[model samples]
Target chain A: MDEHAHPSVMTFVAVWITLLFFTGLTVFAATLELGPFNAIVALGIATIKALLVVLFFMELHYSTALTKVIAIAAIFFFMLLAGLTLSDYLTRGWSTYPSTH
Target chain B: MPDSETVSNNLKHHFANLEQQTATSKFGMWLFLATEVMFFGGMFVSYLVYRLSYYNAWVAGSQTMEITLGATNTAVLICSSLTMVMAVHFAKLGKRKLTAIFLIATLVLGMTFLGIKGVEYYKHWVHHEVPGPNFHFEHEGNFDPRHVSIFFTLYFAMTGMHALHMVIGVGLLSWLLILNALERFSAEYNSPVEIVGLYWHFVDVIWIYLFPLLYLISHRHTG
Candidate 1:
């Protein structure tokens, strides 16, 4: 096989194991009703899954340190987008004063 | 004459090497994912506004959905993402046969997801719960029908968009497979596979948020 014709990167079995764990974690999270913490736990597990995907599948682990930082920044920026939007919504009606009867 | 083995033949002229080409492709994919997040952001805003206004109605509306199915889809999607990673890994390892195989598996699972989604949609249809001009579900004794309607509206908009991406992703991997079959993709130029993997995972990521927001919101009880 031509060197350029095929890459040599082989994924590890551990990657599959960890991914399965997170999938289980997500299903488990759904089983529990944590009130507000429900989203928090789900998102937290998602973040972990996202991290594993970025660090391993993308090969950020072996890349230059700066590249890793850039990858993390890209992810956090997405979170920021979600965070800002949610905050704007969750905060609305918080400051509204009801008229006294 | 430069043989295909020469770097010139494998990498685009603008890129200095295969790595550069892959990097650029990955960067472009991430940029696209950013815009996608914003696209879904608008729907989230709508959900917030309406759910806040009719809190109890929204709760009642959520009850119509089957949590088990939502949960199953979420798991299916995550598993597909892992397979996508494996496909990229095979591409990197220069295993042409394995690469094609894994990519095909990922594509099949994606299609299965769409198939399951269609079934769920059908279930919604038979129940007359799908929102639109023909929607006919009663919100029982105390809930506003409109709020439940809004839930289905957002549901269709968001998940429908997600299913569309799954379609596109399957198409993308199909193209990649064709290239692999032609021996155009190898370790040197597997960026296309890597980039496609990025896109496929990003789709999964979007669903991750959607599952919780759409299905689990305000449901502290498993009732």
Candidate 2:
């Protein structure tokens, strides 16, 4: 839509800088004592980094709306699979143990 | 109104132009990546169940892996991903030579990743960290030998699958380089470059997540 359809040099530099930032952030987070929150914070930063690579670096931002929908559906389905599978395991009852009953 | 007086570029195709072609190719690659996410999703589920069920055993297994190598491989793959994107940029701008250089660099780095991974696997084989009977490696204060098998299972499963992807990606890039050499990819028709770049970056993204989970989680902090 702008003068250039392809990403300019500046966009490329900015994305690389963002990646470096996330890399440093991930390492720093690992150094701290976040306990249960460590994995949470790490995955959060990762998702943001992946989004940047997808939208700008991979040129999803310049894509047609229909293609964007297809891309989004794929990721959404992956998340769906991850969530449902984890929940099934976490919610299972241990009724097989006679000591509890 | 007719082509008798019109140039060859006059008529519009189903898509608007070259930009639209690039867009569709990019989208198709992303959709394909979505399926890959599902592919790895099944493995992650296996990891989650076994990991939770054998919590200490998983940690024991995780301890056998060399974090430094894992971290180093992560950085290497990240560099390759950057090269891959640069290759796409060059292709879009009609620079075949630069694109080929970047693509070749990407392939080399990808192979470098596989080489290092092979070394790690060899170490597993030597140290008996690989899964199956009599395969066990445990640190004095960090793990139980019995539980190390689960760790090795996850270690091989995740990284092994990742290595498989890298092998396939390198082959694809080699083929792309040949196609580029033959003048198949150009500024006007660079969908293949775009598609391959998507695959390469998706692999990098998966490794980005893998590095943290596999390498950096318990750096002398876990009990």
Candidate whose TM-score is highest: 2
Steric collisions counted per model: 14, 1
Task: Give the per-residue lDDT digits (tens) of candidate 2, residues A2-88.
Answer: 415667767877887788788778877877788768878988988888888878777778766776787788778877887887677
Best candidate according to DockQ: 2
With candidate 2 superimposed using the best TM-score fit, by how many Å does residue A28's alpha carbon deviate from the native?
Answer: 3.3
Docking class of 1: acceptable
List each candidate's DockQ score.
0.25, 0.39
The Cα error of candidate 2 at residue A96, in Å, is 12
Per residue, candidate 1 scores C-alpha lDDT tens digits across A15-67 of 65686677677767766767658768877877777676666665556554545
What are the candidates' C-alpha RMSDs? 4.6, 5.0
Give me candidate 1's TM-score against the actual structure.
0.82
Could you estimate the TM-score for every candidate?
0.82, 0.85
